[model samples]
Target: MTNVSRWAAMLALLFATAAWGGLFHAGKLVLNNVDPFWFTVVRYTGASLLLCGILMLQGKVRWELLREHWRRLASLGLMGYGMFGILVFIGLSYSVPSHGAVIMATMPITTLLMRWVFERQRPQLWAWCVVALAIFGVSLVSGVWRSSTGAGHSTAFGDLIAFVGTVGWIMYTRGQASVSKLSVIEYTTFTAILALPGLFAFAVVATLLGYANRPDPADLIAAIPPILYIVVVGTVLAALAFNKGVRTLGAVHGIVFINLVPVSALLISAAKGSVPNGSEMIGTLLIIVALSIQARKMGLGAKAAK
Candidate 1:
């Protein structure tokens, strides 16, 4: 790819990941008023419609692609959009944004292990070291090291659920390669549209089972601003940009950028008057170092390919 194209893709991924960082906080706000089940249903519903509108305006709905890959798209949507969204939000409701962000930062290592297990692709030893550094940095940023201070901002159950959500997202990201014939927007839009019915159905079921409460109309109205941010920025834009970046940079390089999630979360918290502890300050530096190393590696690999 041209340098310009590569840079654009990097920018897109940066924007997407940063927006996702903000999403944890925004989601926390929305979840205060609406439970995870209904919050996901509303977010996905709106995002699907907006994505569909964009697809329609482009005059390329690609019904043939949909018909050709409906099953794959459906499974991806269920796993990524439906399952990931619900579980992450539920985890967010029980935990703080920093915890969610730290869990997300594990994606690079998670992807590495998943590939090794499923595809017999062994990463170089250096790659493991880099990911280990990134994870340690994220742990510091998350104050996981300081959990003994008796802060109740996070819980094991919540972190576990969030980790599962991250894995689902990694699966979704990997699944994108199978549908390489589709454009990023097409993939995101179709998966979201296909996922809506299941999302709404599951939400309804949860409400009926009393696992989640049906959000009142006032609750929806109150959370509209954050919900809109979650849909427009987090779901639609982030999904589109992330897929584009992965397509451009390749998954190994693309996934390393997830380390930015915790950094973004820390910055957001700082902006809100929460001072970063010394560990967080140092951890942020390590995360940036890891990202730089990975980016340089990607550049060298791209040059070699050329």
Candidate 2:
């Protein structure tokens, strides 16, 4: 890409990550009035339709490729979209948005570990150290140390669930190697469409089982604004911008922008008069520093390899 294009891509990625940072907060608002499964169903209903519309307009549906890879796409969609959404939203009901953001910021390191376990691609010793630092930072951000004191225990628990959700996302990302023939937008649209049935099923089951209550029309109305933000900015726009930026700037360079996720979340929270505590601030800084170091190392290694 040209320098101008690269700069634009980087700017796009910055905004994308910031939008995603705001997602946790927006999701929390919706979850206050809607159950996790229903929220996922609602969000993806709009997102999937819009994405399919985009593909249809572009004449890039690639039905043959989708049919050939139906099973893998469905499985990944279930994990990444269905499972991640339910768990994270449930967790958000108990935790704050900044906490969720910090936990998710660990994704790159977790992806590295997943690579090690699944692909046997061992990371260097320094990489392992970075992982440790990231974990420690997450603990501080989640206030895990305060759990035993009957303070922030639920937040810590929620953070754990959120971390597990992040793993689902990592799996979905890694699983993309199998569907490499499809473009990112194509894969995203297909997986989202495929995931909708499973999301709907879960929502139905939860409502039937009394685990989730059907929201009243008033409740849904109250949630409409945040839900709209989540679908339009968080799901569709961020996903498109992120993929485009990563494609243009290269993964190593693009990954560094993840630092903005937690930062933006905290800033948003602060703006709403929920400033982060000292430990949370410190933990956020540590994770950002570690990820920055890791990204720099990876960028240097990539250049050297070239």
Candidate 3:
């Protein structure tokens, strides 16, 4: 690929990251008006349809691949979409968002370990350094350096659940390593589609069990704008860009960009009238430097992989 194409792909991933960041606000809005489980069901359903439309437009839909790999695709859907969502949601109840946020900020390091255990790929000294800086940056941004009182919350349990959720996401990223026959679009769409039944089943069960805070139809209707933005921009667009970046940049390198999430969320939050702070600024710069190193090497790595 030309340098131009590489840059374009990087920008696309950045946009996808930004979309995900926007989801922080969007999710907050929807939670006020809809059941979290119900919201996730709608979000995934919409994402699947949006992806199907995109694949059709690009003439890149690969439904036959599903016939050959339904099991793996469904498993990926369970890892990437299911466990992360369910576990993280439950975890937030037991712990503060700060705790979950810190754990999530460690995604690159977690994914690095997944790469080692699953792919048997050992990262070099530089890779380790990058991940270390990334963790420090994420810690700073996520307020890991700040002290907190337990305030009667089970932060330990919550943090552990969040860690497990992080593992689920790491596995999802690892899914890309072996599924080379499918295009990024095909992989994202099929997995998302196949995962729907399971997600739907969970939502239905929760609703039937009279789960607390379940949203009514009117609440779902009221949350339309944020829901649409989340399903379309956050899930569909972000998934496409992220999968493409992973394909181009390699899983470990591309997954490192998740460090950018806190940065984008902070900036976007600031734009929506939240004040920015010094720690956030420093952390954002740290991520920028770390990702610059990663991207500089990504070009060489991609060329080598080819």
Count of clashes, each model: 0, 0, 0
- Give lDDT tens digits, candidate 3, residues 1-306: 678867777887777767766765677677777665777778898888888888899975667889999999999987888888667655555544334444565677676666687679988788788888866765565455655654332256655676688787778878877788999888998889988999888888987888735677899899999998988887888888988887876676667677666666666667777764576567657766776676667668867977
Query: How high is each candidate's TM-score?
Result: 0.90, 0.92, 0.80
Off by more than 4 A, model 3: 59-61, 89-105, 123-163, 205-213, 276-306
Candidate scoring better on TM-score of 1 and 2 = 2
What are the C-alpha RMSDs, in order, of all predicted structures? 2.3, 2.0, 3.8
Residue 243 alpha-carbon offset, candidate 2, angstroms:
2.4
Candidate 2 clashes: the total is 0
lDDT of 2: 0.84
Distance from true location, Cα of 253 in model 2, Å = 5.6
Per-residue CA lDDT of candidate 1, range 99-171, in tens?
Answer: 6876787777787778889999877776677788877876665556555446633265676788788888888
Report the candidate with higher TM-score, 2 versus 3: 2
- Per-residue error (Å), model 3, residue 175: 1.3
Cα misplacement distance, residue 151 of candidate 2 (Å): 6.2
lDDT of 2 by residue, 52-82 (tens): 8988999756899889998999999989888
